[model samples]
Target chain A: MDTLLSGQLLFAALVSGSLYALIALGLNLVYGTLRLLNIAHGDLVMIGAYTAFWLFTLLSIPPVVSFFVAAALCALLGWAVYEGMFRRLLANPGLAKRVEANSLILFYGISVILQNLTALAFTSSSRGYQYLDTVITWQGVSMTGNRLLSLGVAGGICIAALLFLRFHLFGWELRAVIQRREAAQIVGVNLNRVQPIIICAGFAIAGIAGVLVSMTEQITPFMGFPFTIIAFVVIIIGGLGNIGAGVLAGLSLGLIETYGVALTSPGYRSILIYGLFVAVLLIRPEGIFTKAVRS
Target chain B: MKALDIIFGLALAIGGLLVPLSGDAYLMGLVFQLAMWIALAQSWSMLSSTTGYLSLGHAVFYGIGAYVCVLLTGVVPFGVALAAGAAASAVFAGLIGLPVLRVQGPYFVILTYGLAELVRNVVMRIESALGSFGRMIFMVPSFEVLVWCMVALGILATLGAAAVRHSALGAGLAAIRENEVAAETVGVPVARLKLLAFVASATIPGAVGGLALLRTGYFEPAQAFDPVISFTIVTMALVGGTETVRGPVLGALGFTLLSEALWSSLPQLYMIVLGLTLIAFILFVPRGLSGLADRALGRG
Candidate 1:
């Protein structure tokens, strides 16, 4: 039990939780605005991680610069996915359910495509970044420079996003669109312009998460599945339409999962997270935090 | 028309039996695998299409049945073990369905997937207790008997789908799929219908998986609980048109053959191909191959 409070374990859990929160924020953003469950959210993370990896390894770019580039690329991809696929599907509400189903198939296909392409291009060897002297310890509480930096960055990004939503012209318009698409259109919100930006912003956030995760762990083609499921659990646990709930759920899950692994085995950690999700769904079908209807 | 349908079913059964006699082991193996997949796909369709509960954990039921069959092989005759396996799977489905079916839509899908992962992890942890992972084996039945059993089960499952699709219970399920609140208001027992669909769907996969283990004489947790199995079976059901009887069968056969051919050659792009196939079908041919057939026959 004393091992539970070990600085290493606590630090690791915090780091993991921070990363989870980052990923969940992206999922929450997309679901919040679109009311679409994107199973491919994890794959987007994977794409971001791969993008960072390539930029760092091949182009000899620094990790920090690569992260932003990867994020920007993912934002573009997200916008393209919406413009190409989701737009057509949204026109017919009856076909919406089938389109969602098709998205899973398509994204899963994209995952396979990315994984295989990566495997073909750069053989299936596990790759990790060269860690510099980046460890920081204070009074026996140790944390990695990369992790702490990422946490700070995630915090800054989330805060900025909140402010943007509350104050920016497009952000308010986007919120209006989310609240009532028909009403927003009637009230002169240009949905055609707003939807693309929201999706791109969401993907950019997901890409940032991907880059952060890659820094802590090695990148693999199939790493998307576990992360994807984790993000899903987080968004589901946090209300679907609430960003704060997503952050809260993600951090809580990360802490629980980390402690679960510390107490039992890492193998049982995912089971516990899943069990928690099932329990949450059974107890509160609408999620933990309900979004207030905004005027 | 009903007589013609019955005759077509009988002719297919006779054709299945005659295949093994031709001494083509490769073809026999393919046919056997196809039959098993058809059973699985049909059962999965029963739960997902009929009840509108997209379960990503049907493989969990299949794995349970396989594991039970493996465990009971030492205590009972192989046939008895298979029965026990199927029963265990059905019972397990009923138990899991009680809590899980309360949720709807994506929640249900995610929960079922989690359930499958939970089962897999549990199996992995207890591997030493059960015997080492992939180390345990069950004795196989005679090839002739195995073939006949599989064919019988396949035919029964097909008929079961047809029956369920046309029954009063089927109408209730359809209503639930179309609109849950309305169905509940209209006196349809939503939870009970879902449970029944889940249990019934579970039975075929359980039996099929048990029989597959019997035929293969081996069991592995990862192999038994593979997401690929879940995805493939679901894809077949959806591709064939979810709510139809003939859809899953045709979907399973075509998907299996397509996968066997493509995966063997382009293992890398196979999943991508499958994903593209699913996306294309959903977008353009949302009704699936069965829907296509219905249109060709001017029944749509």
Candidate 2:
């Protein structure tokens, strides 16, 4: 009945969907390459938000620029984590075969560590910044400037990532490593050399996703787990290791979540997200993009 | 050597039960938590380590037991309520496990977690059963009664774990863990056995969680269904050792004492310490304390 309301919801969904897609993409990358779930992806995102928050509040840097700053920081931190934690775990003959289960537990510990440290450094209180908080309205459609900016950054990054994966030489290696580990190895794709870089990039992307969300949202120490859950839902829906489906599913889920909340109370939103997630998981663990999903 | 191991394990277990006789509520409470945690970790170990499927959302059954008994206590005899609650949890797990267990590894993990969160959210909406920060009081028989119940539950948990570890059913679980397809090819009833294990695993945690609620005399969805509880149970089991009853028992008790120390001194830092400990355990001591004990005994 209300076109304006529907339009507003649609826009909001696109923004959220794009953000979720970025997160799913990042998680998918790690899962795809290493055959490990980085449950710490959410914590990395939280840290990115903190990085952006501190950059703006402490040093008076513009929030937009802090996007790259946060990304770079996470990449560095991710590489260190990869070297320190994952490399050792992957090296173990017992754990390497059970990487999926082992990595999940390993990252859970890392998640706990990061969440507690964030609480210690920032305290548990939620923090927000005045970064593009201004609202813009046009012909009955309205959103905060920060929301729009985050959407733009998210879209830009997703597209750039796609293009990079399409054109870059590393893309071929990434695809091979993720899709054809054995063949890739025979073809001289050095998993030892390539995986750490991929993990590092994945961490950076997750940080970028975190910073993007923090722009229009409040930051909290405990926000990591929820975001991690969302990432799980998105990637699962899109099919793990399938970037295209993740993007589409991410956008769709974001829309559904935004519009569902708009239609019902906010409390029921989680129920909707979780219900859909379970349904998809039980029905099709391979994901909606069943055709060549792993590829 | 085997005889010595059994005697050592029994001594430690019996020693643990004797602690509550001291009549210190502080120490008793810690013991109670340790018992509940042991049961939970063992339940998790049953489905996870033996079956090789990491269940990320075990709190669903645990919370079900909490809610079901709380709701049924007055309508039925307290004993009946507790038993019914656990049975209901098993039935529920069996039902969900049918479809969800089809997905393995990360998918299974995510689905289980989602199921728990979903159930908790729905449970919170029941205004009659729980208010915001829901509080309820059922007459706890006695501190000793509570302790004895935990002891009994611990005994039951150990027996169940031992059965799974040593029985032919346990071999099926190991087969599934090694390779489900191969196990199925070898005529292991993968689905049926998994469901059976999933159902059996759900029962004890339900009982443990329900008992914990009755003892607390207060309940809230947030606290009762806390994801952290599942995480804590899993960590305790992992540190003690996975797939063995004694492993979770020792790990749960050891971590409980360690937490009591850390929580009193620095509540904020304790989680970080636990987290770091988990990482360290995964990196250097994957078999946990029980594994270390086994190695020492083997050397000796």
Candidate 3:
């Protein structure tokens, strides 16, 4: 444990964790506020990666610049998804039971559609961009420039999101809805408007994660599903709707994954990660949080 | 109702008989695929529809069954291998259900999903475990034979579904689904009933997975433990209608035919179309075909 706790592993773990946090934050945000699972959340990430990839390849735009553009596009997509799919299911208060059963299928279908569309455009080929192609070493530990860039951006996004939720007026409205929906509305929060904003905001956050991914690792049309699964693991471990705990959980999970792969072969990595995920559920299904903090 | 039942049985038997006599490989292949999906849909319906617990990890049992059959090929008779596969799947379900089943709502859904992924990753580590993408041994069975076997298995599964629909156990599951706390308060023995349903639901998928892999002459991890298969199976059951015997069977048949038609014509865009269809179906027609049929019959 002592030897593995060196700068390199810690840096790697922190980077991976921030990326995971970026993904999980969007997931839990949507879940907490909209009461929808958004199975297509990872597809937002995939689309963001593809968008940045295209911008970089065609317009010579760097991923750093394209990240904002992708995030904005994803926010629009989220708005379309809500207006087209989620609004009606939620409009009726009496349909809550039925909604639970159908929303899963709905989001699943959305994911499949997005994945197919992505494949059609990109031909299912894996792509990556070389941004900040430099390596820096500190005390015999080396870090890729691109990875370090992702790490910095990821941490910035997480902190910014945290602050936005903690102090922003819109964030307060979202929290109110998440904690007590009917009461929040009665207290004069226009749910009709606020809900869509949260949903869009969540998508934008996921888009940022996707662009970050393009800088750090490989991107494929099918990559969205695995990341979605990983995001779910992080949120569950961190506690549903609790961003702080989720970020912490992502960091710990990242550490576990890094050290586990180091100890065993790379193939056993997912096994180790999922084993811990399941163990967490068995031990504390609500996660490590004392209270359910949706924001 | 009895007449409909008899006609359905007669049609199935006649269809099964004609396939062997005609010996058309294409027809045989299509029927085999349809039967495999039907069996899987039926297996998934046993719990998901009745208990309202959407298990996103049902493919683990299917993959396990496939692997088990492949391993026991020379060591045991085909009958023993099939039985062993079913038993193994049920046992695995029992063990997992003890913990995950305690969770409710989305947590239950994702935990089961996680379990399937864990199994898939572990399976990926085994040497030669994922046969060349679906190729089973040559000595397994012909397409016609496999089709007939699947038909027989599917029928048995249907009978099981019918029994569960009318049984006291089914009522208990329904109660649990409606309100777990209330059911428990009313002495419904929620955990035991759920475990039983989970085991029962898992067995046929496991057995049929072995049959599927054996017939296909392969067992790739991606194909065997594919999460999409679970989603598709659930969609079929839902589209046909849940909490009924015929809905899943009809759903399987309808989806198989619809999928084939779409794939043959569109090929490239079929998945997107299917996804759209599923979304539309869930949104506009949540009750599915069986529910439509029930309404036409004016049972309500």
- Winning candidate number (TM-score): 2
Sorting all predicted structures by TM-score, with the top scorer first, yields 2, 3, 1
Report model 1's TM-score to 2 decimal places: 0.93
Docking class of 2: medium
lDDT of 2 at A247: 78
State the lDDT of candidate 2 residue by residue for A153-226, as single tens digits. Answer: 88887888777777898888888887788899999899988888888889999888888877778999988988
Tell me the tens digit of each residue's lDDT in model 1 across A1-295.
8779787777777677777877887877776666657777887887788877777778878668877887899899888888877787666666676544555555655566666766666666777775443778887877778888777777677667778878998778877776677898999988777767777888888888888777778888777878888887887788666777777787788788888888887667756877777777777767876654444
Looking at candidate 3 chain B, the ten consecutive residues that score lowest on lDDT are B127-136
Q: For this target, which candidate reaches the highest DockQ against the unseen true structure?
A: 2
Report i-RMS for every model. 2.1, 1.1, 1.5
Residue clash pairs of candidate 1: none
Chain A fold similarity by TM-score, each prediction: 0.89, 0.95, 0.93
DockQ, candidate 1, comes to 0.54
Predicted candidate 3 versus true structure: per-residue lDDT over A65-91, tens digit per residue: 988899899999989988998897787
Better of 1 and 3 by TM-score: 3
What is the DockQ (computed on Cα atoms) for candidate 3?
A: 0.69
What overall lDDT goes with each candidate model?
0.78, 0.83, 0.81
Model 1: residues with Cα > 4 Å off, grouped in runs: A97-102, A179-181, A291-295, B1-11, B128-131, B298-300
What tens-digit string does per-residue lDDT give for candidate 2 at B1-300? Answer: 557757866775686688778888887787788778877888888888799887888898888888888878767877777797789889899888888789887678777888999988888876433445576766656777777677778777877888888999899999999899999999999999999889988998888878888898777877778888888888888888884566887788788888888888777688888888888998899888888878887842
